[model samples]
Target: MASEPGFLPRDGLDRLIEVLRRDGREVIGPRVRDGAIVYAPIATAADLPTGVRDAQSPGAYALNAASSAERQFAWANGPQALKPLVFSPRERLWTSWHAPANGLHFGAAAHTTRPTAVIGVRACDLAALDLQDRHFLREPYADPAYRARRESLFLVAVHCTHPADTCFCVSTGDGPEAAKGFDLALHEIDAGFVVTSGSNAGAEVLASLPLAVPAEAQRDEARAGVAAAAAAQTRRLPARDLRPALLARIEDPHWQVVAERCLSCGNCTAVCPTCFCNAEIEEPVSDGSVSEHFRQWDSCFTAGHSRLHGIVVRADTLARYRQWLIHKLATWHDQYGRSGCVGCGRCIAWCPVGIDLTAEVAVLCDDGEGVAP
Candidate 1:
C-alpha cells in the first residue's frame, strides 16, 4: 500500500477487538438483528452483518437478507444515530429546594458508558458529529455529558462502498465517504482494510494496531474507491443558496400542501443530527428538599415548542411545519454558518406520514398553488 495510512488484514480487526475487550471496553458495532443492522454489543468482528443489504421506506424498514453473502454495506442510515447515546433523551439539569439552605445544585452528569469502541460509523454520521460539536461543545453553555462521551469513546469510521436512494450527502456538502474526525477510517481493500488517521488520536490508535504502510499506488485506489461510493448515491437536493429561498417562501402555498400530510410528529427533527431542541420537565419532591428539572427531547411540531406567556406562536400546523423546514434549510445557515441537515435520510425513512423532504422541497421551490385545504 503506497499512500495507505495503514493496511490491516481482517485479523487486525480481531486484534483491535481483543485489545478493547481486554481493557474492559464495551465494543459496539453493526450486527444483524431481526433482519436489520443495528448497533449492539459485538463480541467479535465475525458477528457483524456481512454481505447483507438493508431496505428502508417511510415508516417502514426491512433488512434485506444476503443473497450470496457478498455484503458491501448496502444500507444508508440506521433507525438511531450516535446522538442519543451521547446526548441522552432525558437528563437531570439541576436540583432545587425552598428551605433554609435555599440554593440550586447543578446535576453532575457524565457519559460513564464504559470505555467503548464504536465501529462501522458512516461518513454522514461523522459529519453530523461535527455539527454537534459546534452546538453542544463549542457553545458557551457546553454540555459536560456530551463532552465526556466524545472524549472517552474511540471511533472507527467505515468508508461507504454503496449508497442508498434516500441519501443526499453530496448536496449537503458532506459525504458518502469518510473524511475526518475518526480514530480510524477504513476503506475495504480486497480482503483487508486501508486505514488512515483523521487526527493525532487516530494515529495513536494506528500505532497500537498491526498494520502495513501501503505503496503510493494503493493510496490512489483507496481514494478512487471513496469517490466511486459517493458517485453511487442517487439522491440529490439543489441547495445552492437554499437558505434565502426558504426565507423568501415563508408564506408559500407549498407549506399548506406539506402540512396536510405532515402529522406534526416531529420525526424529522428527532432524526436530524443537527436539530438540537429540548424541553425541561421538573419533578417536585414532597419534602421540599429537592426538585429535579429534566431536559428531554422536544420538537417544533408539538404545541409546547413555541409557547410564551401561555400564548403559542405558530399555533397552527401549517406555520409550525413552515418554521421547521425554513429553520432547517435556511435560517440555520444564518445562525450556525452551516446547514442543519446532513442529508442522512433518516427523517425520510422514519416519517410515519411518508413526508419525503426531497418531495416537499421540490414543491417549495415551485411557483404553483399547492393542494388546498
Candidate 2:
C-alpha cells in the first residue's frame, strides 16, 4: 500500500469495506434487490452483484445476469441516485408549539445522520451531486441537513466500463470516467481495479490497503476500457446545449404530442437525480397544541405544484409537460449555470410510458414553428 495511483486486487475490496466499517462509516453500494440493482447497506464485498448488468430503454428496464464471472460491476446505473441519501425525500423542517405565555414558538426539528461511505457511484450521479451542491450548499442560507450528511460522507466513484442502452453521460461530458469530486475512484479491469485517490481522506484509506502501483500496461488497458464504454453509448440529446432551442420552442406542438402519452405521473422527476423540487406539508397535533412541518419531494407534473390563488397555473397536461422540459433543459442553465440533467437516463428507464426526453427534444427542435390548431 502506498499513497499513489495503484492497483487494488479484486479480493482487496473486502479489505476496503472492512476498513470503512472499522472507521465507523456505514458502507453502501449496489446490490441485487427485488428486481434491480439498488444502493443498499453492504457489510462485505460479496454483497456486490456479480455477473449482473441491466438492459434499459424508454419506460423499460430489466436486469440480465451475465455469464462472465469476471465482471463484478457490469450494471451502469440504478433507478435511485445519490440524491435521496443526502437530500432526503421526506424530512421534518420545523415544529411549532403554542402556549399561554407565547402564542406560538417555532423551533428546528431534530435530525440524525451517520458517517457513510458510498461505493460504486457512477460519473453521471457525481455530476448530479455537483448540481445539488450548488442548490443546497452554495445558497445564502444553506440546507443544514444536506450539509451535515454530505460533510460526513465518503465517495467511492466507479468508472463506467459497461454503460446501458439509455446511457448518455458521454454526451453530457460527465462520465465513462470521473475527473474529480470523488475521494477515491476505481476502474475495473480483467485483473482487478485501478484505483486513485483525489483527497487526503481517500489517500489515507488507500494507504492502509494492500495495493500496488498499476503497471503502465495495466493503466493503458483501464483507459481503453473506459473509452470503449463511452463509444458504446447510442442515445443522447440531439444537441449538447438545448437551453436556447428549448426556450424558443416553449409553444411547440411537440409538447401536446408527448402530453397525450404522458400520465402526468411525475415518474421522471422522481427518478431524476438533479430535480430539487419539493412541497411542504403541515400537520397539526391531536390536541392542536403543536404543528409539524415537513418537506417532501414534489414534481412539476403535479397540478398542485403550479397552483396560485386557488388556480392551477399549468392546468393542462401539455402546459405541465412543457414546464418540466423547460425547467430541466432551458431555465436550469439560467439558475445553476449548468444543465440539470446529467444524462443518467433514469428518467427514461423508470418512466411508465417510456417517454424519452432526448426524443422529445429532437421533435421540438425539428420544427421550430409552432404547429397550428
Candidate 3:
C-alpha cells in the first residue's frame, strides 16, 4: 500500500483497468452512448469517452468535442449514476406456489452479484451514494439485494474539473473534489492523473500500478482545475438548510406557478441520484398456481403513490410536486442528516420543459408579494 500520492501516466489507465479485471471485477466506466455519456462495461482505456465534453442546461443536454484528445473525464456526468448498479431498476423478491400436499410454499428469489469496479465516478455522485447507503444499508432493516451489490462495488472517483452550467455541487458541499468514500480517487491533468487511495483495497490497487510521485506542477494543476470548477458553477440553492423555509411555504402560490410548467412525468426523480422511492408488485400465472413478487423503482409524482384506501392523497399535480420538493430539500435533512439532493443538477437538465429546481426554490424562498397562505 502506498502512503504517498502517485502519478499514473495517461497510458497507464489501461493497466488500472486490467488490474481490476484480473481481480475478477467487472470494469464499468463512462462511455458515449445515444448522444450522451453513460456507464458501460470497459475493457481498456480506449473504451472511455475520450475528447468528449457535455453541455447541460435546464431541460437540455448535448455532447461536443473537446480540445484535448487525451481527456476522458472532461464531462460533468450522465443521467445515470451509481444508483442503478446497486438498487436495481427492478428485481424479483420472491416466488410463491400452491401445492396439493402443502397449502402454499414461498421461496426467495435467487440472485448472484459479480464484484464490479466503476471508474469515472464524480464527487457529487459519491455524495448521493452515501445517502443511498444510509437509506438501504441502515441497521435493524437492510435490503439484502442492495447490500450484496453495494458490498461488491469498488468505487473510483474522478474529481470534477469541468462542470456544467446547471451544476451546483459547491453550494451543497458535495463536490468539485472527492474527499472520501472511494477505493481510488483520480485527479486528471493534461499529461496524466494524480491518484490516491482512500481505502486499504484502493491502496493495494494503487501500489500495483507503475506510478511515479506526482510532480509539484501536476498537483498544482489538479488543485487549480477543481477550484475553477467550483467557481464556474452559476446555479445554486437559495440556502443550504431550506427545511424551515420550505415547510413554511407548503401552500405558497409558487407551487401553482411551478406546476404549470411541471408535467409530473417523474423525469427528475428518475435521474435524481438520491430519490429512493419504490413499489412492490406481484405477477401471477394464468392458472394462479404460482406468483412472483418484485420491487421496482417508484416515484412520488405518480398518482398511485399517494393512494390510501379508495382515495388518493395529493391528487393534483401541485400537491405531488410539493411533496417531492419538500421531501428532497427539507424533510430529507431530518431523515438523513443532510439534504437529499447532491446538487448534481440532473433534475434540471433532464426535465423536458426545463424546470430548474434551484430557480423554483429561489422563488419559493422569496418574501415577495403574491405569496399565498
Candidate lDDT values, in order: 0.75, 0.87, 0.91
lDDT of 1 at 147: 85
Off by over 4 Å in 1: 1-4, 22-24, 67-72, 98-113, 213-224, 367-373
* Residue pairs with backbone overlap in model 2: 59-354
- Indicate which candidate wins on TM-score: 3
TM-score of 2: 0.95
lDDT of 1 by residue, 29-51 (tens): 88777656678888877887777
Quote model 1's TM-score.
0.88
Residue-level lDDT of model 2, residues 54-73, one tens digit each, is: 99988889999765676778
- Ranking under lDDT, best-scoring first? 3, 2, 1
lDDT of 3 by residue, 210-282 (tens): 9998889999999999999998887887545889999999989989999998899999999999999999999
Name the regions of candidate 3 deviating beyond 4 angstroms. 367-373
Worst 10 residues of 3 by lDDT: 364-373
